[model samples]
Structures are given as structure tokens and as C-alpha cells.
Target chain A: MKFLGVIIVCLTGGLLLYGTTDFPDWGDPSSPASTHLSDYYIEKTIEDTKVPNIVTSVLADYRGFDTMFETAVIFTAGLACFILLRDFRGKKERFYRHKPTGVVLHVKDGKKTLTVGKEFEHMDKDWVPSDLIIKTVCRILIPFIQIYAMYVVAHGDFSPGGGFQGGVIFGSSLILLAISYDLKTLVNRIKEKVLGIFAALGVLIFVGIAAICMPMGGNFLDYTALAPLVWDPHHVRALGMLGVEIGVGFAVMAVMAIIYINIVSEGRHDEGL
Target chain B: MHWPIDLIVLTFVIFCAIAAISVKDLLGTAILFGAYSFMMCLLWAVMGAVDVAFTEASVGAGVSTVFFVAAVFRTSRRTKD
Candidate 1:
């Protein structure tokens, strides 16, 4: 404990302060970030894609390959989480968890073993937890939060929101459920198996959209080839970009949620995967 | 959206990160790290990076926190000197 305190004072405190210094001076008009590769996207994207939102253009069309890998990053994270945390016991092997011999007790039922650590405070099994009120609120809030995340994705062509934002919002909504209710509920409701699938599918969606352009294509993600029937290639391009955003959003949300779940529930146990 | 509010949010973020990393207790640090993510979300929103804001909020604030806690479980609380 004392060592960490000293390390933070010596190392982290200064670095944290350093990281925030000036920080591009808050949308400086002269900043390169506000000017170059993005400037082209901002100006040309709306005309080419017919989407008012410029960031979406950059993410999906201009540098979509980056987005695809970003999705893969999430996919890898999910895999890592599963490998780190998911319990794997052959159906025949009886579950035996190391409990704190003096105080911790283990109760097994079927495939699950709930450990009671010595330091754990006893609660009546039937008692509703204190966070239930917040849980109730989350139950009500989840649909709205999810809907808003989707809206962020759908409207990425218009304004400030896009895949990464929507993904975070989506992931947070699931986290709220875990926090307010219990992790067990979230695990049950959102199966670990499903999250892995979505992560992969997200990458596929982005790559698939881009690959379509190659055949009748101008470039890897040339949206004009997508719907040759559409008189305005811009509109078709915009639609394709939207699809890419949806994919990215799902991948990011699923993988992040998985990471959190692994850390919170199983990692603390300090057992080998 | 609000400048002062945003500044406050940013300040809180810095504070949390400092607290999280600096704290002697690993569990405390892990929990504070979660708070840092939530604050970062607010900072992203205020900066008009709504997409990054949402991602930070969800992953950093919510899920990442859980992951850290779980990681803590698998490891000892004390940092080996």
C-alpha cells in the first residue's frame, strides 16, 4: 500500500498532469488535426456520400480499413476476456474451488459455484440488495439508452455521434444493468457466447461492404458500386457508411462489455484461465 | 456543452486518474480508475467528440472497471516491491 502511494506521487501524478497539457488548445482553427486529411473528408464527404456528418465519412469511407481493424481489436479483446475468465470444467469433473479455509465457504449447484469469502458480509439470500432501486431505474432506462445509442449510429451521417460513441453508450447500458442488478443477471441475459459472435460479425460487415466495391468497384470501399441503380452515388455511399457504423458499434460494445465482465466477476479470483 | 461544467468534469477526471494510480490500495485504485473513465466520458462530450465520448463512457467507465476488478481478483492486492 505504501509503495503504490509513493509510486503515484513520484510517477503518475506528474505524468497525468503532463498528458493534459494544452491538449491541442481546444479546437484551434490552425491545428493540423482540424485542417488536413479531415478537411478533405469534411468538404468532399457530404457531396460524395450525401451525409452531413463528416466524422462518419472519415470512419467508414475515407479510412474504413482502420475502422475494420478497430472492430477486430474489440473482437480480440472479447477472445482474451473469454480465455482469461470463462470457467471450463469437463462435465464429468466435479467443481472444486479454493476457498479461504477459515472463513470462505463454497456452495456448488450444478455447474455454478458461489464462493463466500471470509471478509464477505452475510446477507439473507432472499433479501433484495440495496442497489435494487438503481436497478429498477436501469431496467427502465436501458431501452432508452440503447435506442439513443442506435440513434447515434443512424445519425452519424448528420452530426457529432458515430460508431465509437454509440458503441460506448451501448456498452455502458449493459454495464448499468450489471451495476444496478447484478453481474449474474447480465451474464444470464446477455450470453457470453453471443458477444463473441457479434464481435466477429462486426468486422465482417465492414469488410463485406468495402469488398463489394472491388467487383464493380472504384476502390476498396467505393460506395458508388454498391447500388449502380441509384442515380446519385452519394446517397448509396452514405447508406454503405451507415452500415459500417452499425457494425463498428456492435463490435465495440460487445467486446468492451465482455472485458468488464471478466475483470469484475472472475479475474479477482486469481485462478488460472 | 457547458464550459465551466466541462472544466469541472475534466478536473474530476484528472483527480480520479491521479487518485486511482496514486492510491496505496490496489482495490481503491481499480475502483477510482472506473471513476476516471466516467469523467473521461463527460470530457469527450464537452469536447464535441460525441463518438469517442460514448465509447469512453461505456468501455472506460462501465465495463473496463469491471474488468479491472476481476483482474484484481486474479492477482494480489499488494504490489510486490
Candidate 2:
């Protein structure tokens, strides 16, 4: 049966390779991607928005509607993680197998034998300390990564990096902290409550920007008419785009980290050491 | 037709995925799954799907590996040869 399964998998992989070969060429400037419905987003975005990331321009302004749902994607992921891993926060985790209430003998420092139970230390023997160099590097890199993510969010009118890429990059840096230090340390760094609040706030901010345009008798995401404070329509549009992008970056980063942490921590405690 | 770097990344992805499915050691299988994600990320980047590559690199290469390994932690990692 295993042999037959292997053969079937191989055939499926072969089909996938054959299909991908017919996909759009890598980095083809004239492909269907570069020629889209919105020419202004691609051609004049740099000069108008004062940003230099094309993908960002497309995501933040031209297609902000798609991005609203994208933030919800992250929010749903966060909710899923919370539902899967956490149980009443303050409650102590129970063992999968029935652990006896009696005391247990543990050896420490080779000379002293200790009996601990009921409320023993939560530390596990297999838990390894993070390397000094690695942890130091993670600490150093985090600020730089956040700066880059912000830059990407800020400059979506001239280049490739946009909200989604910036969000994932930001998420990875947080995961790095989790790996280099420990889950508990990350929990402290990014509190669950803060993540939930920020995610909802991001959506509200996006809607508020839309509401500003709605009263002016323009389309819901019309950036061209969002002027009055700034005479230049371009400036107001750019400002609105960036505001939404920042929100997306935060929501995605927070939610992905939440999911990763939940899965990791649950797996750890479930397997009694 | 002449993407040597892509060829290397694609080869790496294929090998890792194959090894992940084939390995008798469950722990090794989980680790190989991570390697598979990393290679897929690299491959996507080479193809200029930077966004797709970014998500894959973070969620697939980094987090998914941790998830699978954590799962193995609760169970015996030994597999019958």
C-alpha cells in the first residue's frame, strides 16, 4: 500500500511540474501583470504619491478593497490560534496521561536528590538555552527589520516591496525572537491583548479613511478627491494609502506570530517530559 | 532557460520534499519539511513572486517547521523501517 501511495504521489508531482511550465514567464515586464486596468497606478504613481514601490501603490490605493479583507485574514488567523492553544489563561495545564498526585524523585547537580510534585518547576530537561551570539544578533536585527518594514509601507509608489511582503518580513523577525529566546519571552514582548486590539483598530482606520471620501460624493476608495487639508489631490491620496498599508503590516505580523506561537507552545506542554 | 540558481533551488526543494516523505525517522521528516519550505521560498523569489515567496518563507519555512516538530515532541519520533 505504501508503495502504491508513493507511485501516486510521484505522478501527481509530475503533473504539477508540467502545469507550471505553462505559467507566465519570470519577471516578464509585458506580461498580463504589468498591463492592468489601472495605468495611473503604474505610470504616474511615483511622482504623485512620493513613494517608490509599484506593488505598494497597487495594493494601498488602487486595490485597497482587497487589502481590507487581507487584514481580516490575519485577524481570523489570530482568533484561530487563540482558540486552538489557550485555555482560560490562568488555569494550569493538565497532563495528557493521568499523572499521580504523589511526589516524584528528581536528581539535581549529581549530589542532591530532590523530591518535587504538585507544584514543581515548569522547566523541562530537554529545553536548551539559546546561544549568546544568536540571541544578540536577533536583538540587533529586530529594530532594523521593523525600520525596513516601515520603509516598505511608506514607499509603495516606486518599487516592489508592498504591504504583504513588509507584513511577512515583520512577522519573520518576531518569529526569530521566539526561536532565539523562548515562547514566554515572546509572549511578554507581544501581548495577546495588544495584538487583538491593533488588528481591529487597523480595520477601523481603513474604514475611517473610506468614510472621509464617502461624504465628498466620490467612490468609496477614491483618493483623488480626498483633498482640502492638502490642495494637492495626490498628497491626500498618498497619505490615505500609507495609513492603510501600515495597518495591514501590523495585523499580518501580529496574527502570523500568534499562530506560530500557539502551535509551538501547545505541542510542547502536550508531550509530558 | 538558463537559470542556474533557480535550478539549484528547485532541485533543493524537490530533494527535501522527497526526503521528507521518504525518511523513516519522524523527527528527520519534520526537519526536512522545513527545508522544503525554505527551498520553495527561494524558488518563488527567483521567479519574482516576491510576495508569495515572502509568505512561504515566513509561514512555510519558519513557522510550519516549528509546528510539525512541536507535534512530534508529543509522540515517539521512531518509525518502522
Candidate 3:
């Protein structure tokens, strides 16, 4: 059976490589894609949307409907992860550590809970003393990483990064915090409810901006219709794109956090890596 | 110049892909998958698709690797097959 599977995989891979042989050469000027809308987008993206980055303008302005659905798809993925993995049942065993002397306490009862104070802290089953170097370095670096992420999101019109990339970077910073410390540190800082709300809010911001355009005498996602709302009407499209990018950034960041938290904790919202 | 760099990255990508699948240790596979993603990101950058390269670096190489590690932490490290 294994040999048959390997043969099938090899055949499929060969067929795929063979299929690529018939395609246009890389960056062929007269290829179908280059001859068609590529020219228009390259030439007129700046004039049309006031965004210098053609990719940003094309993604958020010219083909915004597609991007909107992409945000919805991300939101749906987070929702699906939440629905499938979230475990509401309490864990039967809980561990707490006394901060002063590092005395570990284990409670076996599922119903009874302890009131954690300064002396007592929640501990994971695989808890080890968090390294001072890792914690200190991450503490110092997280701010810069977060700042760079915001820059990527804000400067998408003039640069390579947009909301998705920026959001992922920001989410990874949060994940880094979890890795350096523990999952409890992250969960305590950002609540599960807050993450869910932000995820939904991000998608709402995108749809809301798009929907507002329709009532303002333009088609869906028409930034030109948003001219009246902003102070500088000439750069309204750029501003609109920025707004949409921010919305995407929020959604992606929250969803990344939600998925990480859920998976690491196995829906219990407690001790994890 | 570009072709040589591209060729090197593509070779690494293929190598990582094969190694990741064949590795019996799931932890090793997760790290190899990350190496595969980083190589793919380099290939995308070489092709002048900077935006795609950025996405691949952050989403593919950065966060997804952490996700895989977290998953491995929760489950068994050894694969049955």
C-alpha cells in the first residue's frame, strides 16, 4: 500500500512539472496576464487610488470585493477553530505554585477552585523556571516588533507589507511572549472574550466601510463616494485603503492569537506551552 | 546571478519538503517545515514578489512554525508511520 502511494505521488508530481512546461516564461511581456489588466493596473494604480504600491491599490481598491471575502474567510477559520476545539469542561487536576519558596501544590478536585493571590500563582503541568535571559530579551524586543508591525500596516501603500503580513508579525510577537514565558502570561494579559470581540470587530470595520459607500451614492467599496467624509478629498481613496488595511490588520492579529491560544490550551483556557 | 540564488533556494526547498515528510520525529518535521517555508520565502523574494515574500516569511516561516511546535508539544513526538 505504501509503495502504491509513493508511486501515485511521484506520478502526480511529474505530471505537475510537465504541465508547467507549456506555461509562459517568467515575466514574459506578451503573456496573457501581462497583455491584459496588468498594464492598466501598473500604469493607472497611482492615479486611480493614490496608492503608490500597485499591489496595495489593486488588492484594496480595484479588487476590494475579493479581499473583503478573504477577511471573512480568515474570520470563519478562527470561528471554526473556536467551535471545534473549545473545551468548556473544567480540568480535574490543577497545580499552583507558592511564589515565595517555590513550593508546588496540586489540587485534584475539579469543582473546588483556589483564590490565587500574590503568594499563589497558577502553574502548568510541565512548568519549569522561565529563563531570565529569554524573558528579559523578549520583554525588550516585543515593543519594537509590535512597532514594526504597525509600520508595515500603515505604510502598505508605499511598501511591500500590508495588513496580512503586519498582522502575522504582530501575532507572532504575542506568540513569542507565550513561548518565552507561558500560555498563562498571554491569556492573563489578553482575555479570550476580548480576542473574539476584536476578531469580529476587524471584519465589521471592513464590511462597514464598504457598506457605507453604497448609501453614499456609489457602488460597494467605492472610495470615491467616501470623498465627502474625509478632510482631503483628493487623497480619499488612499485614506480608504489605509482604513481597510487597518481593519484587515485587526482581524488577522486577533484571529492568529485566538487560534494559538485555543490550540496550545486545547480549549481549556489553562496551562499550556 | 539571480538564477544561481534561485536555484540554491529551490533546491533547499525541495530538500526540506522531502526531509520534513520522511522524518519520524514530529518535532524535527515541524522545524524542517519551517526551513521549507523560509526557503520558499527566499525564492519569492528572488522572483521580485516582495509582498508575497513578506507574507511567506511572517505567516509561513514565523507564526506557523510556532503553531506546529505548540501542536507537537500537545501531542506525541513520534509518528506511527
Candidate with the greatest lDDT versus the true structure: 3
The best candidate in terms of DockQ: 3
Query: Compared with the true structure, what per-residue lDDT tens digits does model 2 show for residues A1-273?
Result: 989988998899899989999877855666676577446665787776666666666677777788777777778878877787765433233211113542333334444433334554333345554589988998999889878877765664445555656776777777777777766567767787886777677667777777778787778978666786455665787777876777777777777676666666662322121
Error of 2 at A47 (Å): 6.6
TM-score, per-candidate, Cα-based: 0.72, 0.73, 0.98
lDDT for A234 in candidate 3 is 97
Query: Which sections of candidate 3 miss by over 4 Å?
Result: none
Residue runs of model 1 more than 4 Å from their true location after superposition? A1-38, A90-134, A229-234, A267-273, B1-14, B38-50, B73-81
Q: Write the per-residue lDDT of candidate 1 for residues A141-160, one digit (tens) a residue.
A: 99999999899888888877
For model 2 the local lDDT of residue A52 reads 61
Where is model 3 chain A poorest over a 10-residue stretch in terms of lDDT? A43-52
- Tens digit of per-residue lDDT, candidate 3, span A32-81: 99999899999998788878899999999999999999999999999999
Model 2 misplaced stretches (Cα beyond 4 Å):
A7-51, A89-137, A229-232, A267-273, B49-56, B67-81
Interface RMSD of each: 4.3, 3.5, 0.6
- Residue A48's C-alpha lDDT in candidate 3? 83
Per-residue accuracy of model 2 over B1-81 as CA lDDT, tens digit each: 649998888889889977887899898998999889988888888777775676687668766776677667656788766
| Docking level of model 1 | acceptable
Which CAPRI level is candidate 3?
Answer: high
In angstroms, give how far residue A102 of model 3 lies from its true place. Answer: 1.4
